[model samples]
Structure formats: structure tokens, C-alpha cells
Target: MRPEALALLAAACWAVAALFSAPASQRLGAIAFSRWRMLFASLILWGIALASGGWRSLDASAFGLLALSGVIGIFIGDTALFACMNRLGPRRSGVLFATHALFSAVFAWFFLGERLWGWALVGSGLLVAGVMLAIVWGRRGDEQHGWEQTRGRLAVGVALGLLAALCQSVATLMLKPLMASGIDAVAGSALRMSMALLAHGLLLSTGWRGARPLAPMRLRDAGLIFGSAAVAMALGMTLILQAMKHGQAGLVAVLSSVTPILILPVLWLVYRRRPAAGAWLGAALAVTGTAFILLR
Candidate 1:
């Protein structure tokens, strides 16, 4: 498939993953769900790596980079994101995550020397503004008016979102160097998941006090969540890394800025949820701006 197609496919898969994961978060708790999700992803990626090549094909440096990426991006970024979810709620957290594009662009610029054009700058600004508008104006089922009951959570959400963005940016920036040095994307992804596994283990051991046992789940729910995890987080990330290998970082970043749009339709379908008109408009604006940035 073409790089753009792959990136869009990845985005779609990520959206599907989020659909199943929201309920899982409510059931198993976010930390537990995240850990198990990574565990499953690690196993899947590991098998793919082994099928493609023996373990010996992975070098120490590549392993190190992947490991670091996994820990920082998956464990730290994801954990902080879950916290943001609790504090900011999904709508606000969703908007904050749009910041990842800006952070990623900056990281790519400094480390990879990826240049942004004038339209790209304008588009990114619009995208950020759009997402913020969406969050600020969006209303939930519980909220009759937009921005209701978001007092303390907003501040915490912003901080956590910034942390998530920083970790994600650093991890993404590291990918270019690793791939340039000849790391196989599949094997690298496997190693990254392996690091995530270790981090999950640590979190379970130290971070999750009074963690609940795995709850009994319906076969349908289990299947959906697992499928989502494989397709969204693991497969999507692999495709994204592959696209980065073949495409410009700025373009890839711009395309990825539309993940929340991919997310909205899925949420509507699965949960019968809909964003407020303002939120929808904001998302549209963000996508429009991001598109301009990429195309120009």
C-alpha cells in the first residue's frame, strides 16, 4: 500500500482501538488496561519479529533505542494520558493531545532537521486552535452546557498532556535515527514493545497498589478490545514508523493530527456518543488546517 494509505489505515485502526478501550478503562481501570494492552501488543510484535528474523538480527543499539521509545512513549506517555483522561475527561484530553503534532514537529525540526513551510505553520496553528475550541465548546451527556464541571481537571489535564506530548515527541524523533541506522521496523517495534512490557511490569509492581484482579469479561468485549489493541496501537504504530521511513516527518506529523477525527465517528457508532456542534466544527477546522499544512 502507499504510505498515505498506510498512515490513514493506521489512524483508522487507532480510532477503533480507542472505541473498545474506553469501556475497558471503565472496567479494568486505565493502568491495568494499559499494561495488559501493551503486554498483548508485545507478544504480537515479538512473534512478528521472530517470524521475520531470528533474535540475533536485533542489535544492541537498536534494542536500546526501541526500549527507550517503548518506555517513554507507551509507559510514561500512556500512563500520564490515562491520568489526563481522569482529570480532563476524554474530550478535553483529546484536544490536548493535538499538541503532539506541534511537539513532534519541533522535535523533528531540531533532531531530524525537518523543515516546515509557511502554510504548515499556519495550518498547525489552526489545528491547535481548532482542537482547543472543540474541547472548550464541546458538551458531554453529563454536561448540558459546554465546559461545565471542568474546574480542577483542566489544569491537571494540561500538565499531563504536555508530559505525554514531550514523551511522544522524543520517542518519535528517536525513530528516524534508528531507522536511518538500519533498524528493521518490525524488529524495532517488537523491541519497543518489549521495553513497554518491562515498564508495565514495573508499574504493576510499584505503581498499581490495590490493583484489581482481571475481571470476567464477555467474549465479545474481550475480542473487541484485543482486536482494537492489535490493530490500533501495535499495527498502527508499525505502519506509522514505516511511513516515516519512506515519507517526510512533517507530512507524516500533519496527517497524524487527524487521529481525533478518526476517533469521533467510532465513538459515535460504538457508544452512541456525539460531540457538540462546536466540537465537531473545531475538529473540522483542525483537520482543514492540518491538511493545508501537509499539502502545501
Candidate 2:
């Protein structure tokens, strides 16, 4: 498959995982859900790495970089994303999270010295406008589905989602050079997850009340969490890194953040209601912005 297709496939994986995330994150709480998800992902990736001898390519320097990348990307970013989901639900949260593509472009411009002066600037404005539009008007006044209910302050969830996007972009930027140099995607991903799992372990050991799950995990919750962990962390993220080996960071991110567009149909199916007009318009703007960056 082409690198761009790999990025889109990663987006599909994330969209499916987002469907599971609302339930599991609500049941397990964001921190605990993330802990379990990273644990599962770490183990699965390690199994693949060892079996395929991908671990052989992991030097100490590679380990250090990938490990830090994992902690920032998966540990902080995934936790914040789920916390955002807990408050904003998946659909709106997804629109917010899609800003990572824009964030990645900006970060690349500053850090990697990638140029961003043409259509990219216009797209950035559109992306920001779309995010605000979705958050402000994505739901009807009468729409009271569990997924659309605001859990806490709207401000807090929006902050977390954008923070998740920023962290994701930074982490991806950090890994571009390594991935482009032919690192084994599986082993590198395993190392990253392992480091993130370690971070979660320490966070749990702190007995921070906020870090604990509100309820015990049910069998069904376990299934949901495992499936999401396997699909999103083990497969989707690895595919993004693989795409990075050949694709430009901005293009890859723009494609991978198509999660907002991909998740809407499933959301409609589950709710038995079409999305609000604002949701459709916001998604169209965000996707068009992505295409501007992609095709430029």
C-alpha cells in the first residue's frame, strides 16, 4: 500500500477505536483506561517484535528516543484524549483532536524548518475555524444522547483535546528522523509503549484519586478496551510511523487525522439520527483544510 493509504488506514483504525473509547473511557475513567490500553498494546507489540526479530534494530539511542516519544505521545496524549472524550463525547472530541494535523504542520515548520507559507496557512485558519464551529454548534439543543452530553465544563475538555493534539504532533515530529532512517516500526512502537506503560505504573502507584477508575472493569469493558488497544495503539500508530518512513510529516498527519470524517457515519448509525448541520459543515471544512495541505 502507498504511504498515504497507510495513513488513511491508520485513520480508520483510530475511528473504530474512538467508537470503543467512549464506552470504555466512561466506564474505566481516562487514566485507568489508558493504563490498561497501553499495557495491552505494549505486550502485543513486544510479542510481534520478538517474534519477528525487530528488536535487533533497536539501538540504545533509538530506544531512548522512541521511549520518550511513546511516553509523550501515548501516555500523555492518549490519556488527555480519553479525558476529553469523557467530557465532550467522541464526535466533538474527534473534531478537536483532528487539529493535530494542523499542529503537526506548524510544529514541523518551526522545528524541522518545513515551509508552510502557501495554502497551508489558509488551511490552518480553516482548521481552527472548523474546530470552533464544531464545538460551538455541533449538537442540537434537544440532542441529549449520552455521547453528546457535556460531562463537565466545556472549556476543560476543549483544552485537553488541543493539548492532546499538540503532544501528538511533537511526538511525531521527534520520531520522523528515526523512522525515516529505517527503524523497525514494530520494535520502535513496542519500546514507546513500554515506556508509556512504565509512566502509567508510576502514576498509579501515586494513589492519586484522579488516576483511579471510578468503577471496576466489567468483562465487556475489558473486551472493548482490548480491542481498542490492539487496533489503535498496536496497529494504527505503527502504521503512521511506517508512513513517516516515506511520507512528509504534514501530509501523513493530515491524512491520519481524517478520524473526524470517518467517525461521523458510525455515530449516526448508533444514534439513529443524522448529525447536526453544524457537524456536517464543520467536518467538511476540516477535511477540505486537510486536503489543501495534502494536495499542496
Candidate 3:
């Protein structure tokens, strides 16, 4: 399959994970949940790397790059995102996070010399607009805490969301050239996850940001966190790295940003209720924009 397809698949995986993670995050606290999830995902990726002999291909420099990317992407970016979600609710946080596509595109253009012009630019704009529309106007289920509840901390939440976007975009751009140079995506993922695990461990140990004492996880919470690790961090991130290997980093980011749009159908199916009309329209616009990018 093409890298674009893989990126979309990653988005689907993320959408599923997001649905499952919210409750666990609420129960465990964002920092605790994120730390556990990263540790779990690191172990999974390490096993895959060992089994596939992906571990043997990395040299010191590649290892360093992958580790740095992991620190930025998983440790910093994901933690900030979880915090943002906790503060602002998923809908508003998601809208801000989607700006990662624009950040990725701009960074890739200036730093990596990857350019998007004409239809690609238009498609990217439309795609971003559609995602923002869906997130802002889409049906709010019971899961999301209402935006009105977050008014007091809206500025902080927005800042954290933008920080998450920046970290994620920079991490992806950092990895693109390495992956293109024949780095093993699985091993690279494992290395990055391991680094992230260490970083989170440090944060927890230092009691940074009032990192609460490790909460006891209920069976359901454990299950949800593990499932999220497997699908979102392990599989989704691997697919994203592979996508960056084969496609423009900006384009991959744009494609992956469709997670919000993709979640509409998932929500409808799971809840047996339809999204608002705006969601349907947003999905159409996003799909049309994606087609332009792909077909152009």
C-alpha cells in the first residue's frame, strides 16, 4: 500500500484509540496514563524490533535521531496533548492540534526543502478547514466534557495544544530524512518509544507538574490503556513513520489529520446515532480535498 494509505490507516487507528483513551485518561490522570501507555508501547515495539531483526540495522547516529524524535513526539507532544484534552476537552484541543499539518508543511518546506504548490496547497487548506469544521461543529457525545466547562483555562489549553502540534510536527520532520535513508521503521519506532518511556519515567519520578502518585488501575482502565498503546502508539506511529519514509512529511501530516473526520462514522456506528449535518459536510469536504491531493 502507498504511504498515503498507511497514513490514513494510522488515523483510523488513532480515532479508535482516542475513543478508548478518554475514560482511562480521566481515571488515571493524563500524566500517569501517558506514562503507562508509553511504557507499554515501548515494550511492544521492542519485541517487534527484536523479532524482525530491525534492531540490528541502527547505528549510533540513527539511534540518536530516533531517540530525539521520540522524546519530542511521544514524550513531550503526547503528554501536552493529553493535558490539553483534560483542560479544554477533546473537541477544542483537536482543532488546535490539527495545526500540526500546517507546521509540518512549513517546516518541511523551509528545513527539508520539500515543497507543496498549486493543487497541493489548495487541497491542504481545504483539508485543514474541513477538519476544523468537523471538530468545532460535530456532534458532542457524552464522552467529551463541554467546551463551556473549560472557559477558565481556555488560554492554557490552547497554548498546550499548539505546543503539542509544534512538537509533533518537528519530530516528524526530524525523522523523515532518516527514514528515507533506509532506517528501519520498526526499530526506529522502538528506539523512540524507549526514549519516551524514559522521559516520562523521569517526569513521574520528579513529581513534575504535581504528577500524582501512581493511581491504581481498574481492569477496564488497564485494558483501555493497553489497547490504546497497541493501536495508537505501536501501530499508528509505525505507520506514520513509514508514511514519512515514502511520502512528503507535510502531506502525510495532512492525511493523518483526517482522524477527526474519520471518527464521525465510527461514532455513528458505535453509538447508533448520526452526526450533525455539519459533520457530514465536513467529511465530504475533507474527502474531496484528499482526493485532490492524491490525484493531483
Q: What pairs collide in candidate 1?
A: none
Which candidate should be chosen as best, given TM-score against the real structure? 3
Candidate 3 worst ten-residue window by lDDT: 140-149
Q: Could you give me the TM-score of model 3 versus the true structure?
A: 0.93
Identify the superior model by lDDT, candidate 1 or candidate 2.
2
Per-residue accuracy of model 3 over 1-296 as CA lDDT, tens digit each: 88888989998998888877877886788888998898888889989999999888799988788889999998899989988877776666778898998898899889988888988888888898899888788864544434325744678989999999999999989998899988888889999999988987777788576566346888898889999999999999999999988898889999999988887776677667677777877887898888888888
Candidate achieving higher TM-score, 2 or 3: 3
TM-score of 2: 0.90
Q: What is the C-alpha lDDT of each candidate?
A: 0.70, 0.85, 0.85
Better structure of 1 and 3 per lDDT: 3
- Model 2: how far is 4 from its true place, Å? 1.9
lDDT of 1 at 164: 81
Stretches of candidate 1 exceeding 4 Å from the true structure: 1-5, 54-57, 140-154, 206-221, 271-274
Runs of candidate 2 with Cα error greater than 4 angstroms are: 116-137, 282-296
